[model samples]
Target: MYEIFEQLLSERGVTPYRVAKETGITTATLTSWKQGKYTPKPEKLQKIADYFHVSLDYLMGKNSSLTTCPDCGFTYDPSYPEDIETHIEQHTAWEKAVKEFGEIYSDGVKCEQIKAENRKISHDLSLPLEERCEAQIRVLRCLFSRSLVANSYSLDHVPFDTYVAMMLNNPSYRKNNLEDDLLQALIDKYGTASGMNSGTIYHIPNKSKAISTKDKRDIKRDLDRIMEQLSNQEYGPAAYDGEELSPEAAELFRDELEIALKRLKLINKEKYNPHKNKK
Candidate 1:
Protein backbone atom coordinates (compact mmCIF):
# COMPACT_ATOMS: atom_id res chain seq x y z
CA MET A 1 0.00 0.00 0.00
CA TYR A 2 2.80 2.46 0.84
CA GLU A 3 4.68 1.50 -2.34
CA ILE A 4 1.53 2.08 -4.44
CA PHE A 5 1.09 5.49 -2.78
CA GLU A 6 4.73 6.37 -3.53
CA GLN A 7 4.31 5.20 -7.16
CA LEU A 8 1.24 7.39 -7.65
CA LEU A 9 3.13 10.41 -6.33
CA SER A 10 6.07 9.60 -8.62
CA GLU A 11 3.80 9.19 -11.68
CA ARG A 12 2.19 12.61 -11.02
CA GLY A 13 5.56 14.24 -10.21
CA VAL A 14 3.97 15.63 -7.02
CA THR A 15 6.26 16.32 -4.08
CA PRO A 16 5.30 15.53 -0.47
CA TYR A 17 4.92 19.26 0.22
CA ARG A 18 2.34 19.63 -2.62
CA VAL A 19 0.50 16.43 -1.61
CA ALA A 20 0.27 17.62 2.02
CA LYS A 21 -0.90 21.08 0.96
CA GLU A 22 -3.47 19.77 -1.55
CA THR A 23 -4.87 16.87 0.55
CA GLY A 24 -4.45 18.61 3.97
CA ILE A 25 -2.49 15.52 5.17
CA THR A 26 0.53 15.91 7.47
CA THR A 27 4.09 15.22 6.30
CA ALA A 28 4.67 13.17 9.44
CA THR A 29 1.75 10.85 8.53
CA LEU A 30 3.12 10.47 4.98
CA THR A 31 6.62 9.68 6.31
CA SER A 32 5.18 7.15 8.80
CA TRP A 33 3.16 5.49 6.04
CA LYS A 34 6.23 5.39 3.73
CA GLN A 35 8.28 3.69 6.52
CA GLY A 36 5.51 1.04 6.98
CA LYS A 37 5.12 2.17 10.59
CA TYR A 38 1.56 3.56 10.33
CA THR A 39 -1.61 3.23 8.28
CA PRO A 40 -3.84 6.26 7.63
CA LYS A 41 -7.37 6.43 9.07
CA PRO A 42 -10.20 5.51 6.66
CA GLU A 43 -11.12 9.22 6.16
CA LYS A 44 -7.48 10.13 5.46
CA LEU A 45 -7.20 7.21 3.03
CA GLN A 46 -10.31 8.39 1.20
CA LYS A 47 -8.93 11.94 0.97
CA ILE A 48 -5.64 10.64 -0.51
CA ALA A 49 -7.50 8.41 -2.96
CA ASP A 50 -9.74 11.29 -4.06
CA TYR A 51 -6.80 13.67 -4.49
CA PHE A 52 -4.90 11.21 -6.70
CA HIS A 53 -8.08 10.19 -8.61
CA VAL A 54 -7.56 6.52 -7.77
CA SER A 55 -9.84 3.96 -6.07
CA LEU A 56 -9.23 3.29 -2.35
CA ASP A 57 -8.74 -0.42 -3.06
CA TYR A 58 -6.01 0.37 -5.61
CA LEU A 59 -4.30 2.78 -3.21
CA MET A 60 -4.42 0.20 -0.37
CA GLY A 61 -2.76 -2.57 -2.51
CA LYS A 62 -5.86 -4.81 -2.08
CA ASN A 63 -6.42 -4.56 -5.88
CA SER A 64 -3.27 -5.14 -7.93
CA SER A 65 -5.14 -4.69 -11.23
CA LEU A 66 -4.38 -2.37 -14.14
CA THR A 67 -5.66 1.18 -13.94
CA THR A 68 -9.43 1.51 -14.52
CA CYS A 69 -10.46 1.94 -18.18
CA PRO A 70 -11.25 5.59 -18.71
CA ASP A 71 -13.99 4.62 -21.20
CA CYS A 72 -15.76 1.82 -19.26
CA GLY A 73 -14.69 2.80 -15.71
CA PHE A 74 -13.62 -0.83 -14.95
CA THR A 75 -10.28 -2.22 -13.83
CA TYR A 76 -8.67 -5.12 -15.70
CA ASP A 77 -8.21 -8.33 -13.65
CA PRO A 78 -5.27 -10.68 -14.29
CA SER A 79 -7.58 -13.73 -13.92
CA TYR A 80 -8.83 -12.93 -17.42
CA PRO A 81 -5.39 -12.41 -18.98
CA GLU A 82 -6.54 -12.10 -22.62
CA ASP A 83 -9.38 -9.69 -21.74
CA ILE A 84 -7.04 -7.75 -19.45
CA GLU A 85 -4.56 -7.08 -22.29
CA THR A 86 -7.28 -5.85 -24.64
CA HIS A 87 -8.93 -3.72 -21.93
CA ILE A 88 -5.64 -2.14 -20.90
CA GLU A 89 -4.87 -1.33 -24.55
CA GLN A 90 -8.25 0.33 -24.98
CA HIS A 91 -7.77 2.29 -21.74
CA THR A 92 -4.35 3.53 -22.91
CA ALA A 93 -5.82 4.69 -26.24
CA TRP A 94 -8.69 6.42 -24.43
CA GLU A 95 -6.28 8.34 -22.19
CA LYS A 96 -4.28 9.55 -25.21
CA ALA A 97 -7.46 10.63 -27.07
CA VAL A 98 -8.75 12.50 -23.99
CA LYS A 99 -5.45 14.40 -23.64
CA GLU A 100 -5.53 15.38 -27.34
CA PHE A 101 -9.19 16.47 -27.14
CA GLY A 102 -8.43 18.68 -24.11
CA GLU A 103 -5.68 20.48 -26.07
CA ILE A 104 -8.02 21.05 -29.08
CA TYR A 105 -10.79 22.37 -26.78
CA SER A 106 -8.34 24.81 -25.16
CA ASP A 107 -7.28 26.11 -28.62
CA GLY A 108 -10.94 26.50 -29.71
CA VAL A 109 -11.72 28.59 -26.59
CA LYS A 110 -8.76 30.91 -27.29
CA CYS A 111 -9.86 31.37 -30.94
CA GLU A 112 -13.42 32.33 -29.86
CA GLN A 113 -12.05 34.84 -27.36
CA ILE A 114 -9.88 36.43 -30.06
CA LYS A 115 -12.87 36.69 -32.48
CA ALA A 116 -15.00 38.39 -29.74
CA GLU A 117 -12.26 40.94 -29.09
CA ASN A 118 -11.90 41.64 -32.82
CA ARG A 119 -15.69 42.15 -33.20
CA LYS A 120 -15.68 44.65 -30.31
CA ILE A 121 -12.82 46.59 -31.90
CA SER A 122 -14.37 46.55 -35.38
CA HIS A 123 -17.82 47.80 -34.27
CA ASP A 124 -16.66 50.53 -31.85
CA LEU A 125 -18.88 53.58 -32.61
CA SER A 126 -16.28 56.16 -31.57
CA LEU A 127 -14.04 55.34 -34.54
CA PRO A 128 -14.53 57.17 -37.85
CA LEU A 129 -16.64 55.14 -40.30
CA GLU A 130 -13.95 55.31 -43.02
CA GLU A 131 -11.29 54.14 -40.54
CA ARG A 132 -13.47 51.25 -39.41
CA CYS A 133 -14.22 50.27 -42.99
CA GLU A 134 -10.55 50.35 -43.94
CA ALA A 135 -9.59 48.25 -40.92
CA GLN A 136 -12.23 45.64 -41.84
CA ILE A 137 -11.01 45.65 -45.45
CA ARG A 138 -7.41 45.09 -44.34
CA VAL A 139 -8.47 42.14 -42.17
CA LEU A 140 -10.43 40.63 -45.06
CA ARG A 141 -7.47 41.12 -47.42
CA CYS A 142 -5.13 39.38 -44.99
CA LEU A 143 -7.51 36.43 -44.57
CA PHE A 144 -7.95 36.02 -48.33
CA SER A 145 -4.21 36.33 -48.96
CA ARG A 146 -3.41 33.74 -46.31
CA SER A 147 -6.04 31.37 -47.68
CA LEU A 148 -4.61 31.63 -51.18
CA VAL A 149 -1.08 31.04 -49.87
CA ALA A 150 -2.14 28.03 -47.80
CA ASN A 151 -3.81 26.48 -50.81
CA SER A 152 -0.61 26.97 -52.90
CA TYR A 153 -2.53 29.23 -55.30
CA SER A 154 -1.97 32.80 -56.53
CA LEU A 155 -4.22 35.69 -57.62
CA ASP A 156 -3.51 34.74 -61.24
CA HIS A 157 -5.04 31.32 -60.63
CA VAL A 158 -8.34 32.88 -59.52
CA PRO A 159 -8.25 36.31 -61.11
CA PHE A 160 -10.37 39.23 -59.87
CA ASP A 161 -11.25 39.85 -63.56
CA THR A 162 -13.01 36.48 -63.68
CA TYR A 163 -15.14 37.32 -60.66
CA VAL A 164 -15.91 40.83 -61.99
CA ALA A 165 -16.91 39.39 -65.37
CA MET A 166 -19.18 36.89 -63.64
CA MET A 167 -20.76 39.59 -61.48
CA LEU A 168 -21.18 42.11 -64.35
CA ASN A 169 -22.70 39.44 -66.61
CA ASN A 170 -25.24 38.48 -63.90
CA PRO A 171 -28.26 40.81 -63.62
CA SER A 172 -28.56 40.11 -59.85
CA TYR A 173 -25.09 41.62 -59.30
CA ARG A 174 -25.93 44.76 -61.33
CA LYS A 175 -28.97 45.64 -59.14
CA ASN A 176 -26.81 47.81 -56.80
CA ASN A 177 -24.96 50.35 -59.00
CA LEU A 178 -22.77 51.74 -56.18
CA GLU A 179 -21.48 48.26 -55.33
CA ASP A 180 -21.01 47.44 -59.01
CA ASP A 181 -18.92 50.56 -59.61
CA LEU A 182 -16.70 49.77 -56.62
CA LEU A 183 -16.28 46.19 -57.81
CA GLN A 184 -15.41 47.43 -61.33
CA ALA A 185 -12.76 49.80 -59.98
CA LEU A 186 -11.26 47.01 -57.85
CA ILE A 187 -11.24 44.61 -60.76
CA ASP A 188 -9.56 47.21 -62.99
CA LYS A 189 -6.75 47.65 -60.45
CA TYR A 190 -6.20 44.01 -59.35
CA GLY A 191 -7.70 41.85 -62.09
CA THR A 192 -4.31 41.12 -63.65
CA ALA A 193 -2.05 41.52 -60.58
CA SER A 194 0.26 38.54 -59.93
CA GLY A 195 -0.52 38.24 -56.22
CA MET A 196 -3.05 39.55 -53.64
CA ASN A 197 -0.70 41.88 -51.78
CA SER A 198 -2.87 44.96 -51.06
CA GLY A 199 0.12 47.36 -51.10
CA THR A 200 0.77 46.44 -54.73
CA ILE A 201 -2.83 46.10 -55.96
CA TYR A 202 -4.64 49.01 -54.21
CA HIS A 203 -2.53 51.95 -55.53
CA ILE A 204 -5.11 53.54 -57.85
CA PRO A 205 -3.95 56.64 -59.72
CA ASN A 206 -7.32 58.43 -59.45
CA LYS A 207 -8.70 57.69 -56.00
CA SER A 208 -10.75 60.95 -56.03
CA LYS A 209 -12.41 60.39 -59.38
CA ALA A 210 -16.07 61.57 -59.63
CA ILE A 211 -18.89 59.05 -60.05
CA SER A 212 -19.19 58.18 -63.77
CA THR A 213 -22.20 59.05 -65.97
CA LYS A 214 -23.26 55.40 -65.95
CA ASP A 215 -23.26 55.34 -62.13
CA LYS A 216 -25.35 58.55 -61.97
CA ARG A 217 -27.82 57.15 -64.47
CA ASP A 218 -28.04 53.86 -62.52
CA ILE A 219 -28.74 55.69 -59.25
CA LYS A 220 -31.55 57.70 -60.89
CA ARG A 221 -32.97 54.52 -62.36
CA ASP A 222 -33.01 52.86 -58.91
CA LEU A 223 -34.75 55.89 -57.35
CA ASP A 224 -37.39 55.87 -60.13
CA ARG A 225 -37.94 52.13 -59.58
CA ILE A 226 -38.45 52.67 -55.84
CA MET A 227 -40.98 55.47 -56.40
CA GLU A 228 -42.84 53.36 -58.99
CA GLN A 229 -43.02 50.42 -56.57
CA LEU A 230 -44.39 52.62 -53.80
CA SER A 231 -46.94 54.12 -56.18
CA ASN A 232 -48.05 50.67 -57.28
CA GLN A 233 -48.40 49.54 -53.67
CA GLU A 234 -50.55 52.59 -52.82
CA TYR A 235 -53.21 51.62 -55.42
CA GLY A 236 -52.51 47.86 -55.84
CA PRO A 237 -54.73 44.83 -55.02
CA ALA A 238 -54.66 45.67 -51.28
CA ALA A 239 -56.68 48.87 -51.83
CA TYR A 240 -60.03 49.69 -53.57
CA ASP A 241 -59.83 51.80 -56.74
CA GLY A 242 -60.63 55.49 -55.98
CA GLU A 243 -61.04 54.63 -52.27
CA GLU A 244 -58.80 56.15 -49.57
CA LEU A 245 -56.97 53.89 -47.08
CA SER A 246 -58.21 53.55 -43.46
CA PRO A 247 -56.84 56.49 -41.44
CA GLU A 248 -54.49 54.29 -39.38
CA ALA A 249 -52.99 52.50 -42.43
CA ALA A 250 -52.74 55.78 -44.36
CA GLU A 251 -50.86 57.47 -41.47
CA LEU A 252 -48.49 54.50 -41.04
CA PHE A 253 -47.60 54.26 -44.73
CA ARG A 254 -47.30 58.06 -45.01
CA ASP A 255 -44.78 58.23 -42.17
CA GLU A 256 -42.74 55.28 -43.55
CA LEU A 257 -42.63 56.69 -47.10
CA GLU A 258 -41.65 60.13 -45.77
CA ILE A 259 -38.72 58.58 -43.90
CA ALA A 260 -37.68 56.53 -46.94
CA LEU A 261 -37.84 59.60 -49.24
CA LYS A 262 -35.76 61.62 -46.77
CA ARG A 263 -33.09 58.87 -46.78
CA LEU A 264 -33.02 58.80 -50.57
CA LYS A 265 -32.69 62.62 -50.67
CA LEU A 266 -29.79 62.43 -48.23
CA ILE A 267 -28.03 59.76 -50.36
CA ASN A 268 -28.50 61.91 -53.50
CA LYS A 269 -27.16 64.99 -51.72
CA GLU A 270 -24.15 63.07 -50.41
CA LYS A 271 -23.41 61.66 -53.87
CA TYR A 272 -23.34 65.11 -55.48
CA ASN A 273 -21.84 67.05 -52.56
CA PRO A 274 -19.14 64.68 -51.30
CA HIS A 275 -17.15 67.55 -49.70
CA LYS A 276 -20.12 69.15 -47.91
CA ASN A 277 -19.20 67.75 -44.46
CA LYS A 278 -15.39 67.90 -44.87
CA LYS A 279 -13.43 70.46 -42.85
Candidate 2:
Protein backbone atom coordinates (compact mmCIF):
# COMPACT_ATOMS: atom_id res chain seq x y z
CA MET A 1 0.00 0.00 0.00
CA TYR A 2 2.77 2.43 0.89
CA GLU A 3 4.72 1.53 -2.28
CA ILE A 4 1.67 2.22 -4.48
CA PHE A 5 0.90 5.45 -2.62
CA GLU A 6 4.49 6.60 -2.89
CA GLN A 7 4.59 5.74 -6.61
CA LEU A 8 1.38 7.72 -7.25
CA LEU A 9 2.79 10.72 -5.44
CA SER A 10 5.99 10.46 -7.47
CA GLU A 11 4.05 10.19 -10.73
CA ARG A 12 2.15 13.38 -9.91
CA GLY A 13 5.35 15.17 -8.83
CA VAL A 14 3.78 15.80 -5.43
CA THR A 15 5.99 15.53 -2.38
CA PRO A 16 4.80 14.45 1.06
CA TYR A 17 5.40 17.97 2.37
CA ARG A 18 3.14 19.49 -0.34
CA VAL A 19 0.43 16.87 0.26
CA ALA A 20 0.48 17.48 3.98
CA LYS A 21 0.37 21.25 3.44
CA GLU A 22 -2.46 21.14 0.92
CA THR A 23 -4.59 18.40 2.57
CA GLY A 24 -4.07 19.69 6.15
CA ILE A 25 -2.65 16.34 7.20
CA THR A 26 0.00 16.46 9.91
CA THR A 27 3.64 15.54 9.24
CA ALA A 28 3.43 12.89 12.00
CA THR A 29 0.54 11.15 10.27
CA LEU A 30 2.29 11.24 6.91
CA THR A 31 5.47 9.93 8.48
CA SER A 32 3.56 7.11 10.15
CA TRP A 33 1.87 6.26 6.81
CA LYS A 34 5.25 6.22 5.03
CA GLN A 35 6.88 4.06 7.74
CA GLY A 36 4.00 1.49 7.54
CA LYS A 37 3.27 1.90 11.24
CA TYR A 38 -0.50 1.48 10.80
CA THR A 39 -3.20 1.54 8.17
CA PRO A 40 -5.04 4.85 7.69
CA LYS A 41 -8.66 5.13 8.81
CA PRO A 42 -11.39 5.36 6.16
CA GLU A 43 -11.81 9.13 6.65
CA LYS A 44 -8.07 9.75 6.29
CA LEU A 45 -7.89 7.41 3.30
CA GLN A 46 -10.77 9.31 1.70
CA LYS A 47 -8.98 12.64 2.21
CA ILE A 48 -5.85 11.21 0.60
CA ALA A 49 -7.79 9.83 -2.37
CA ASP A 50 -9.67 13.10 -2.80
CA TYR A 51 -6.46 15.13 -2.65
CA PHE A 52 -4.71 12.98 -5.27
CA HIS A 53 -7.75 12.38 -7.55
CA VAL A 54 -7.39 8.60 -7.20
CA SER A 55 -9.65 5.84 -5.94
CA LEU A 56 -9.42 4.57 -2.34
CA ASP A 57 -9.01 1.05 -3.72
CA TYR A 58 -5.93 2.24 -5.60
CA LEU A 59 -4.35 3.90 -2.55
CA MET A 60 -4.91 0.79 -0.46
CA GLY A 61 -3.61 -1.58 -3.17
CA LYS A 62 -6.91 -3.46 -3.24
CA ASN A 63 -7.60 -3.20 -7.00
CA SER A 64 -4.83 -2.53 -9.51
CA SER A 65 -6.96 -1.67 -12.54
CA LEU A 66 -6.68 1.94 -13.78
CA THR A 67 -9.42 1.76 -16.40
CA THR A 68 -13.17 1.95 -15.81
CA CYS A 69 -15.70 0.22 -18.08
CA PRO A 70 -17.59 2.52 -20.46
CA ASP A 71 -20.70 0.31 -20.70
CA CYS A 72 -21.16 -0.79 -17.09
CA GLY A 73 -19.01 1.84 -15.31
CA PHE A 74 -17.36 -0.91 -13.29
CA THR A 75 -13.65 -0.89 -12.37
CA TYR A 76 -12.25 -4.37 -12.86
CA ASP A 77 -9.03 -5.82 -11.35
CA PRO A 78 -6.30 -6.15 -13.97
CA SER A 79 -3.70 -7.85 -11.75
CA TYR A 80 -4.07 -11.14 -13.60
CA PRO A 81 -2.35 -11.25 -17.01
CA GLU A 82 -5.03 -13.24 -18.85
CA ASP A 83 -7.92 -11.34 -17.27
CA ILE A 84 -6.42 -7.93 -18.09
CA GLU A 85 -5.58 -8.91 -21.70
CA THR A 86 -9.07 -10.26 -22.41
CA HIS A 87 -10.74 -7.30 -20.72
CA ILE A 88 -8.65 -4.81 -22.76
CA GLU A 89 -9.38 -6.55 -26.09
CA GLN A 90 -13.12 -6.72 -25.39
CA HIS A 91 -13.30 -3.11 -24.19
CA THR A 92 -11.39 -1.78 -27.21
CA ALA A 93 -13.55 -3.69 -29.72
CA TRP A 94 -16.78 -2.60 -28.06
CA GLU A 95 -15.68 1.06 -27.96
CA LYS A 96 -14.66 1.09 -31.65
CA ALA A 97 -17.98 -0.40 -32.81
CA VAL A 98 -19.95 1.96 -30.56
CA LYS A 99 -18.06 5.05 -31.80
CA GLU A 100 -18.73 4.15 -35.46
CA PHE A 101 -22.42 3.43 -34.81
CA GLY A 102 -22.81 6.64 -32.80
CA GLU A 103 -21.58 8.84 -35.70
CA ILE A 104 -24.01 7.25 -38.23
CA TYR A 105 -26.90 7.30 -35.74
CA SER A 106 -26.21 10.95 -34.88
CA ASP A 107 -26.31 11.98 -38.55
CA GLY A 108 -29.66 10.21 -39.08
CA VAL A 109 -31.06 11.78 -35.90
CA LYS A 110 -30.05 15.28 -37.09
CA CYS A 111 -31.86 14.77 -40.42
CA GLU A 112 -35.00 13.55 -38.68
CA GLN A 113 -34.86 16.41 -36.20
CA ILE A 114 -34.61 18.96 -39.04
CA LYS A 115 -37.58 17.38 -40.81
CA ALA A 116 -39.69 17.57 -37.63
CA GLU A 117 -38.70 21.20 -37.05
CA ASN A 118 -39.60 22.21 -40.60
CA ARG A 119 -42.98 20.53 -40.26
CA LYS A 120 -43.64 22.48 -37.06
CA ILE A 121 -42.57 25.73 -38.69
CA SER A 122 -44.81 25.14 -41.68
CA HIS A 123 -47.86 24.26 -39.56
CA ASP A 124 -47.60 27.25 -37.21
CA LEU A 125 -50.10 29.67 -38.76
CA SER A 126 -49.26 32.34 -36.19
CA LEU A 127 -45.90 32.93 -37.89
CA PRO A 128 -45.88 35.24 -40.93
CA LEU A 129 -45.25 33.77 -44.38
CA GLU A 130 -41.93 35.60 -44.69
CA GLU A 131 -40.72 34.21 -41.35
CA ARG A 132 -41.67 30.70 -42.37
CA CYS A 133 -39.95 31.10 -45.70
CA GLU A 134 -36.79 32.36 -44.04
CA ALA A 135 -36.77 29.43 -41.62
CA GLN A 136 -37.12 26.94 -44.48
CA ILE A 137 -34.38 28.65 -46.44
CA ARG A 138 -31.98 28.43 -43.49
CA VAL A 139 -32.71 24.72 -43.08
CA LEU A 140 -32.14 24.08 -46.81
CA ARG A 141 -28.87 26.00 -46.71
CA CYS A 142 -27.61 23.88 -43.81
CA LEU A 143 -28.60 20.65 -45.55
CA PHE A 144 -26.97 21.77 -48.80
CA SER A 145 -23.75 22.59 -46.95
CA ARG A 146 -23.68 19.13 -45.40
CA SER A 147 -24.28 17.49 -48.79
CA LEU A 148 -21.34 19.40 -50.29
CA VAL A 149 -19.03 18.10 -47.56
CA ALA A 150 -20.28 14.52 -48.01
CA ASN A 151 -19.72 14.65 -51.78
CA SER A 152 -16.20 16.10 -51.44
CA TYR A 153 -14.62 12.71 -50.74
CA SER A 154 -16.28 10.78 -53.54
CA LEU A 155 -14.20 10.66 -56.73
CA ASP A 156 -17.00 9.40 -59.02
CA HIS A 157 -19.42 12.26 -58.21
CA VAL A 158 -20.05 14.85 -60.92
CA PRO A 159 -19.26 18.55 -60.45
CA PHE A 160 -21.78 20.65 -58.49
CA ASP A 161 -22.69 22.63 -61.65
CA THR A 162 -23.60 19.43 -63.49
CA TYR A 163 -25.70 18.27 -60.54
CA VAL A 164 -27.62 21.58 -60.53
CA ALA A 165 -28.13 21.37 -64.28
CA MET A 166 -29.42 17.80 -63.97
CA MET A 167 -31.91 18.90 -61.32
CA LEU A 168 -33.05 21.89 -63.39
CA ASN A 169 -33.43 19.69 -66.49
CA ASN A 170 -35.58 17.18 -64.64
CA PRO A 171 -39.28 17.67 -65.54
CA SER A 172 -40.39 16.83 -61.99
CA TYR A 173 -38.26 19.60 -60.47
CA ARG A 174 -39.54 22.01 -63.16
CA LYS A 175 -43.17 21.14 -62.29
CA ASN A 176 -42.70 22.46 -58.70
CA ASN A 177 -43.15 26.20 -59.28
CA LEU A 178 -41.76 27.26 -55.90
CA GLU A 179 -38.72 24.93 -56.15
CA ASP A 180 -37.94 26.14 -59.68
CA ASP A 181 -37.11 29.65 -58.46
CA LEU A 182 -34.78 28.31 -55.74
CA LEU A 183 -33.09 25.89 -58.22
CA GLN A 184 -32.72 28.71 -60.76
CA ALA A 185 -31.05 30.91 -58.12
CA LEU A 186 -28.59 28.10 -57.38
CA ILE A 187 -27.87 27.66 -61.10
CA ASP A 188 -27.22 31.37 -61.57
CA LYS A 189 -24.76 31.38 -58.66
CA TYR A 190 -22.84 28.16 -59.34
CA GLY A 191 -23.51 26.98 -62.91
CA THR A 192 -21.24 28.06 -65.77
CA ALA A 193 -22.27 29.35 -69.22
CA SER A 194 -21.50 25.96 -70.83
CA GLY A 195 -23.25 24.26 -67.84
CA MET A 196 -20.16 22.21 -67.05
CA ASN A 197 -17.21 23.34 -64.93
CA SER A 198 -14.93 22.01 -62.17
CA GLY A 199 -15.40 25.06 -59.94
CA THR A 200 -16.09 24.28 -56.28
CA ILE A 201 -19.33 25.48 -54.67
CA TYR A 202 -19.13 27.33 -51.36
CA HIS A 203 -22.13 27.39 -49.01
CA ILE A 204 -21.27 30.63 -47.25
CA PRO A 205 -23.18 33.66 -48.54
CA ASN A 206 -20.23 36.10 -48.46
CA LYS A 207 -17.15 35.37 -50.53
CA SER A 208 -13.65 35.89 -49.13
CA LYS A 209 -12.89 39.53 -48.35
CA ALA A 210 -9.62 41.37 -47.81
CA ILE A 211 -8.88 40.53 -44.17
CA SER A 212 -6.92 43.43 -42.77
CA THR A 213 -6.47 43.87 -39.02
CA LYS A 214 -9.49 46.17 -38.93
CA ASP A 215 -11.56 43.68 -40.91
CA LYS A 216 -10.65 40.87 -38.53
CA ARG A 217 -11.64 43.05 -35.58
CA ASP A 218 -14.98 43.86 -37.20
CA ILE A 219 -15.64 40.18 -37.88
CA LYS A 220 -14.84 39.37 -34.27
CA ARG A 221 -17.25 42.07 -33.06
CA ASP A 222 -20.01 40.69 -35.27
CA LEU A 223 -19.33 37.19 -33.97
CA ASP A 224 -19.53 38.40 -30.38
CA ARG A 225 -22.85 40.19 -31.00
CA ILE A 226 -24.38 37.08 -32.60
CA MET A 227 -23.20 34.90 -29.72
CA GLU A 228 -24.63 37.32 -27.17
CA GLN A 229 -27.98 37.38 -28.94
CA LEU A 230 -28.04 33.58 -29.03
CA SER A 231 -27.12 33.31 -25.35
CA ASN A 232 -29.75 35.87 -24.30
CA GLN A 233 -32.60 33.93 -25.90
CA GLU A 234 -34.66 32.36 -23.12
CA TYR A 235 -36.99 29.35 -22.97
CA GLY A 236 -39.83 30.84 -20.86
CA PRO A 237 -41.83 34.07 -20.78
CA ALA A 238 -38.63 36.08 -21.23
CA ALA A 239 -38.26 34.46 -24.64
CA TYR A 240 -40.57 37.16 -26.01
CA ASP A 241 -37.95 39.79 -25.20
CA GLY A 242 -35.77 38.55 -28.08
CA GLU A 243 -36.43 37.51 -31.66
CA GLU A 244 -38.78 34.52 -31.60
CA LEU A 245 -37.11 32.22 -34.11
CA SER A 246 -37.64 28.50 -34.59
CA PRO A 247 -35.09 25.80 -33.67
CA GLU A 248 -33.86 25.81 -37.25
CA ALA A 249 -33.13 29.53 -37.09
CA ALA A 250 -31.11 29.12 -33.90
CA GLU A 251 -29.12 26.30 -35.53
CA LEU A 252 -28.41 28.42 -38.58
CA PHE A 253 -27.34 31.35 -36.42
CA ARG A 254 -24.86 29.19 -34.52
CA ASP A 255 -23.53 27.56 -37.73
CA GLU A 256 -22.96 30.90 -39.42
CA LEU A 257 -21.35 32.35 -36.30
CA GLU A 258 -18.94 29.40 -36.16
CA ILE A 259 -18.05 29.80 -39.84
CA ALA A 260 -17.29 33.49 -39.39
CA LEU A 261 -15.07 32.83 -36.38
CA LYS A 262 -13.18 30.09 -38.26
CA ARG A 263 -12.66 32.37 -41.24
CA LEU A 264 -11.17 35.01 -39.01
CA LYS A 265 -8.88 32.48 -37.38
CA LEU A 266 -7.68 31.18 -40.77
CA ILE A 267 -7.10 34.71 -42.05
CA ASN A 268 -5.07 35.55 -38.96
CA LYS A 269 -2.88 32.52 -39.62
CA GLU A 270 -2.42 32.87 -43.39
CA LYS A 271 -2.46 36.67 -43.75
CA TYR A 272 -1.57 38.25 -40.41
CA ASN A 273 1.22 35.90 -39.36
CA PRO A 274 2.49 33.53 -42.02
CA HIS A 275 5.28 32.08 -39.87
CA LYS A 276 3.11 30.53 -37.14
CA ASN A 277 0.55 27.72 -37.59
CA LYS A 278 -2.92 28.00 -36.12
CA LYS A 279 -3.25 26.51 -32.68
Q: Rate the local accuracy (lDDT) of all candidates.
A: 0.50, 0.52
Model number with the top TM-score: 2
Question: Candidate 1, which segments miss by more than 4 Å at Cα?
Answer: 64-279
CA RMSD per model (angstroms): 28.2, 21.5
What are the clash counts of all predictions, listed in order?
Answer: 0, 0
For model 1 the local lDDT of residue 276 reads 50
Tens digits of per-residue lDDT, candidate 1, 49-165, equal 878766677687785556554343334554333345445544454455334322111122343455455445545658655554444333333333333222222222233333334
Overall local distance difference test of candidate 1 = 0.50
Please give, for residues 7-87, the per-residue lDDT of candidate 2 as tens digits: 878767889888888888887888898788977788888788778766677678885755555442224454433334445
Off by over 4 Å in 2: 65-279
State residue 252's C-alpha deviation in candidate 2, in Å: 36
TM values, all candidates: 0.25, 0.27
- Any residue pairs clashing in model 1, and if so which? none
